[model samples]
Target: MEHSHTADWWKKSTVYQVYPKSFKDTTGSGEGDIRGLIEKLDYLQGLGIDIIWLQPVYVSPQNDNGYDVADYCEINPEYGTMADFDELAAEVRRRNMHLMLDIVVNHSSTEHRWFQEAKQSRNNPYRDYYIWKDPAPGGGVPNNWQSKFGGPAWQYDEATGQYFLTLFDKTQADLNWENPAVREEVVKLMTFWAEKGVSGFRLDVINLISKDQNFPDDDGSARPGDGRKFYTDGPRVHEYMKELNRRIFKPYNLVTVGEMSSTSLENCILYSNPEQNELSMTFNFHHLKVDYPNGQKWELMPYDFEQLKSLLSRWQTGMQEGCGWNALFFNNHDQPRALSRFTDDSEYRVESAKLLATTLHGLQGTPYVFQGEEIGLPNPKWNGIEEMRDVESHNIYRILQEQGKSPEEAFNIIRERSRDNSRTPMLWDSTPNAGFTSGTPWIKVDERYPEINVERQLHDPDSVYHHYKKLIGLRKKHQILIDGTFVRLDEAHPQVFAYSRVKGQEAVVVVSNFSKEQTVFQFADAFAEEWLEAGPAELLAGNTKQVPPLWKEMALSPFASYMWLIRRK
Candidate 1:
């Protein structure tokens, strides 16, 4: 493990994620554009972020909102021409900030040239580009696998009389990575972007590229309509990543991160460990899925605090022991807003938001702040299903209604779990459309934008945005936040989540009240002993950003957090 003085830039830097479609829309086309992002680089730099992760803006049919790449080498016209992207790259580098793009390689849009040719005839040279199989004995899909969007995972092509694999939308046919030609193509695309001066790539569903050759049927015990067990972290995923990293990424000094969904910890270690030579880090979805009972995304339940603690602690200790690094994040384009999902956004929005930021940033990993998370954005109580634009949300709503659920129940479900909640236009100001676009937005902007937005919070002395800035500043000034060992304290504590980062004789203690109720500050080792009496100590940060009182016999208010630094000789 590299220490702070010698660690790579990414090890000590923070990343800010931008869901391009909702970041800004400069064209008045009701959609975000690359130029709009270029216009906002200053705002991100002001927040002290080192890298920006832009979602896919490649040419596409928008079936899966840019995940279905129709052309790998070109930018979508809605975003702008390739020249616009080149300009953005130049500007980002001039400011000493790196840029990362999402690479959706597991699948391609049906309209892609290769998929089009593959579907033309069975003997076509491109036929091997994607997975294809003949119909079953009874003229049904090849397997019982279900697409993530809805319906069967296989889409029957009338012209070819074969079913093509589409784990996502029917428009996106899964690529056959076993084909040397397909692997070469993916590698060539990676090289193409790297040559263009892109510093990093976020591989989407990369762990699912390989598959079980037998195409066996699932036992139906997975998530509602999931066939992921057969392909997730499949046989040759690590091998392919090793080859990719050795040839293209490592040479270019590019940081590579894979979006590992439904993956195992063992596989994740190999994926990100430097000794394994696969990826720099991975975005694991396990902790984020704790709220989904039985692995079903549509079915919502109150997030389990203990389950969250268990998963986070396991990954934290596991990855460290395995010589792998993690990418810490709470919200992204695919999940509901963080403050609303994990905290009481109504009464404790600001404090809980800061507490969440403090807890995650205090850990030993590269922290990622999703766009607008610093402002304490909450999930919208979207009026009805019709107001939702996310394909997954609409699909689950339809499925729930077909499963005999009442309209009210289905709408409530969508309200609680829709990805649309995070895709709303960035709340910039109090104006209409939240100052995102003068034209209509692709989706409804959150109604609370007037009260909670960048303009309102950027200047507020005690806003979530400034609090996040303080956390970022602290990480920049302290070495322990990056290189120290982590030990979870008070394993059985119910309400207070406590942990310590220790380096030599000095340590930093982070304690957060995870619930919206007053709680006694009792943990494995209170500050009264080694911290208050046996060593020199000082309060580094708190929800109030003040050392207002003594540490002993203090009642932590709802969503309160405090960090103390201790030094011993």
Candidate 2:
């Protein structure tokens, strides 16, 4: 196969995220692995995905699933051996698809030999690999810094009478990237993977890799005594990323993306600038955080269409030439189903799902399809908190309970916003455990699998799967959708979200109705003379009519959307 390095491949390509543990299980062990993924290569290719970003499958104790790595060079026995991974990589190459793996260098499992050796004594050679410090005079934590999952970020160890930093759970200790030896080890690990034919890496919590050495305590306001600033986008983040890129990523032609939590637009531009060899792109959470509560806990904060449109438009236009690419997505392993979160699930789930798909894929970025997203899967409804399996969910549930929140309130919050919402077993068929596993699954399958499995949708031409196929096809066939300049239309229109993609002579207009009520949008006069009836422009959903006098007003039903190709005479 000929290798293409024109930098245009990513611009025109589609990426799919595969959560290994939930994708498929071939061993009847109830856990998905690399071998299972190899078995589904044809399915992925058929879906038109150009890249597969697999979550962590490294050797670990399974504390934070696979995020806590025990050994960077070895594959977990439960997933498969190195031979199975090589086979998977070969299959990806055979299909001309890129294979990307998650890089969890920000932290390592406490069980990692390095961490174990560091914990043994302060004088150990590996002691500098992890962040360790002496306790303050009061013998309390190093500071009032709080873990993202909750509680103090520092955990005390009796052996050395010191504290170790863990931004997530105690079992996952943050690495001290300030040390040159640690940076060298990480670069070596990345090279080891790249040499095995891996094309890229999806960095995990990459922004948190650098920290404010001062370790200042929170002013008792932002986090209620928890210091988050010290841990977010610290002083040397870009420097560290540049070093990693120059040492390992650049030489291999690897496309790298960083999960930059709490990243600002300015910071994102710096991290993703094509000139800066830091990262190929960074996943921005600006739009995703709209519904989040003001403080820390998960609360019901409704979304406004105007605000969403503005946020997306700013990001789209701001990333014109020098800015790095965007990772466009609506749902992922940590997010709830897009159909449930962004649309009205009670009545217009299908239409809304289609609209969401069009809106994401039509943008100027690389679109990522999460497992089961193409079929418009709805969020699972857990009967009780005990049924949830995600660590974040369990931690939030405990925190709510301690705060004297009622069972109803706590359950409602989690049901609306749990990471487990996207972690449910993939609905492959109506069989036991959604055909994801022959035996019981590690996590419970969504109960609606009987009505929403892949088997049924694959047969229905009007299913969400087919709509995704059409949208992806449109993106590939039209240069306007891939590299066009985005222009927002009708900014203040409450019921309508309109945008036009223009690339010289080629232009495509997209209009979406976010509300359940019908909406009528009048096209601007500039498009009147050039507006030729381009067939019933692929209606994502609802009714449309071409009125006379060059006026095209569409009556979009609840959660409806449409795409029209405009041509000049």
Candidate 3:
């Protein structure tokens, strides 16, 4: 525990994630632009954001909301031009904050010139750029692999007589990483952005880039998309990553965080360990999977709290012990708003928001705050099927119906799990369009915008926004918060999640009530009486200013959280 994460830039810095299109719009275009981000620099800096990890703003077909990139070096017209991006990067630098761009190298939009040419003929030079295979024996698709979006992973091209792999959407053709030329091209694209002043890269679905050379069927899997097992941590993943590090990232001294979907702890260590020099950090999605039951994301199921605790503890301990860094996040452009997913967003919105912040930020990782998360935004009412825009949501709905479920059942499930829940326009004020745009927003602003908007909360000290600012400041001021060892407490408590970050004699115990009912946290015999000196612990932060006597136990109001500094003699 003596070794610390104090000196590293990411270890102590708070990163703010911006989902470009829905974040803010200035051109009456109903979409957020790079210029809009430039205008909001002061607002982001005021929130103590040391870095901004912008979601993909690259030129794309809008098939997956900027994820399916058609051009890597240019900015999307919806987001503005390359010159506008330059201005935004300069503004971020002027504010003393770093800019991290989303790098979508796992696949490219079919509209990309390379993919277009690859579809022309089997002998085409661009054919090897994508994963293409001959038809099966019976004149069907190339393999039994299923797409993450829906149906088959293979898309047939009439012109070429071969099926190309599209792990995500049919329009997104997977790249053949086994081809050294393809790898070199990807590195070139990334280098182009780095030379443009980008500080970091958030590699999208990074683990999926390396696939099993021998295409095989996921026969035993009940679901179709079980194909992930083949590519989760493939044969050449580490080799490819190491090469990428040596060629692209290490040269710029840039930080990189790979978004890993189905990665193992052992491999994660190799991917992010500082000694390995592969990545600065890796985003493990296991914590976010607690809500998926039987491995089905569309199923309506309550989050398994115990499963969540165990998974998080494993990652926290495994990564730290393995000399690897962790990237911690609750909400993202791809997930539902955390306030509504984990807590009662209606009644205890403020308290639960603060509690979640206290719990996640106190851990040993580089915390990422999704856009609007600081203001405690909740998922908008799942208006109707027409409002849903994501291909994944629509695909899941159809799949559920094919599995013998009623249309209502499928709609309800997709309503709760759709990416559109988080894609709603940001609520900046009580204005008609939440001040995001003078024109109509791409997605309707949440109706509660009047109550939870930023304009009103910016001046309120007790707002969720202010609470986050305090948490970020605490991490910067208290070195222990960034370098302490994690110790879980009240493991069996259904309503309270508690832990302590200890470093030598200095420690901070974090306690949060996860339920709506009042609860009491008693000092376990070993925690207070046996280990610490007999004295009052200094309160560092809490939703409620009042701290009850902790001689034996302390009462916690519904959703209340506390961070106490305990120094043992």
Candidate 4:
């Protein structure tokens, strides 16, 4: 459980995720690239961001928008050359910030040289690098595995007369980690990035790295295609992660976070145990799964505040001491905006957005701020399914159509839940293409850029941008906010979510209104006595409140939030 490195550094760090394709396009080639990100380092630094987690810029066929890697060692020509990445890494370091690169080792593009070699013949040396098997007696797949993108997970390779494993698209073949050679190659490839000055790696679908060797088929009663339980969080996952840490990450003092899907709390603690010498942290999907119908594929579900609060609290408490850090996020390259998903964005967008930010960032974990989130960006109102670019969105649309859902219904779901929601061009200014590019953007920019762009908000003191700035600064300036213990207050209050972070004598109480209507609540007697009237600095809202409570209850405006520093009476 003991960490060789200091914990304080990570406790106070704020990571910013940049989806390269949508961040900024400098080449005017309709895509954002390394050069474009390099140009924006100053702007990110100005926003008080401490680390940059750049999503995949590696060579890919773009089947899954860069998740399918063709070459781990080379940069995609469309993104830029290796020289540009080196410069970007150096530039970020110059600002005294860190950079984390996406490591997609779970799978590779079917067109990759290794896959191509494997496809030629079963006897090829490269054949073992991927999982391949002959068809069943019935001339069907080896198992009832389902691809995350939809359809069967096993893709038939006619030339070899076998099927290769692909948990995602057919173009992305899952790697066989049982092969020692593959593990060695992954370590070497990771070392290549470490040597290039990448501070860390955000491992992609890392839990899927070690699959169930038995390759069991889904039961007859299983859903159309649900094999995740069999392949996810497999037996050798921890062993593989530990070996990776010992061989590559530990030696370099690198920060590594695993993008683990279907991982339970037990697995999270095991994989991220500081003493396990594995990952620095592992992301939790419990909150994200709230909208999934019985974890079934393509089911309409709604976000639940109580479910989210329980998930966050569990992670915060479960990983309190020796357990590795938790990576906190609401929106990423694959998620819709937090405002739209977590709040009632239709009427209380700004208040709910800021309240959500406060509620999340105030928790005990490493917070990740996705681009445009600071300005309270909501999911774009895409007119039709044709306007979306994400493959998952397209696949879901087709699935909905087959399930008898109307085109309008399909498009509506896509608009509200598509990964494309996060990929919309950055709203830097009110100019053409949201100031992301002069030429046409690779994807359509959100229409609300004129009011939501960074340029306008940066100058306005009351803007969400400035609110985030203060939040970041508060975390940095106050130890209680950064490295304190969390205690949930008024757990049964449906309209209120409150918690206090205490470090010895220093305490900061944070309370948020989760509903659209005002709520009245009183502080715990112990906290009320020591409460200091630190006039509301407006962390997210302009709402103010008087401190101390004995005979009266404090009221919070609709979707309002408050944080106050309290000392011992």
* lDDT over C-alpha atoms for residue 563 of model 3: 86
Say what the RMSD of model 3 is. Answer: 2.7
> lDDT of each prediction vs. the true structure?
0.86, 0.82, 0.85, 0.82
Ranking of all predicted structures according to lDDT, beginning with the best and ending with the worst: 1, 3, 2, 4
Q: Which is better, 1 or 3, measured by lDDT?
A: 1
Q: Give me the candidate number with maximum lDDT.
A: 1
Give per-residue CA lDDT, model 3, range 426-523, as digits (tens).
89999888899999787778888889898999989989999899889988888898778888877678888888888887888888888899988776
User: Per-residue lDDT tens digits of candidate 4, residues 1-569?
Assistant: 22233743666878999999999999788889899999989989988998899999888889988999888999999989999998998898888888999999899998799998998888999999999989998998999888888789998888789999999898999999999999999999999998888878999989998888888887745565588877789878889998998898878777778888878888888877787778888897878877777765356677667877777877887877656578888878888887888777778887777787888878877789998888898988888877888888888898898899998887877787888888888899988888899888888998888888989988988777877777887777777776788787766688888887878766667888888787788767765554434223223323234432322267777887767666554
Q: What TM-score fits each model?
A: 0.96, 0.94, 0.96, 0.94
Clashing pairs in 4: none
Candidate 2 C-alpha error for residue 451, in Å: 2.1
Candidate 2 structure quality by residue, lDDT tens digits, 1-569: 23574754677778889999999999999889889899889988887888899999999988788999999999999899999999999999999899999999999999999999999999999999999988987878888787878788899999899999999888999999989999999988988889889989999989988888887778876657566677678899999989988888778888888898877777778888878878888898778866776733388877766778898888888876546678898889988887887787657778888888877877888888999899888888789888888888888877887899998898899988999889887888998888899988988888888988888988988888888877777777888887788888765798888887877766677778888897787766565444435323333322233322224565666766767676544
What is candidate 2's CA lDDT for residue 173? 97
Return the top candidate by TM-score. Answer: 3
Misplaced by over 4 Å in model 3 are 1-7, 221-225, 530-535
Off by over 4 Å in 1: 1-7, 221-225, 525-532, 545-553
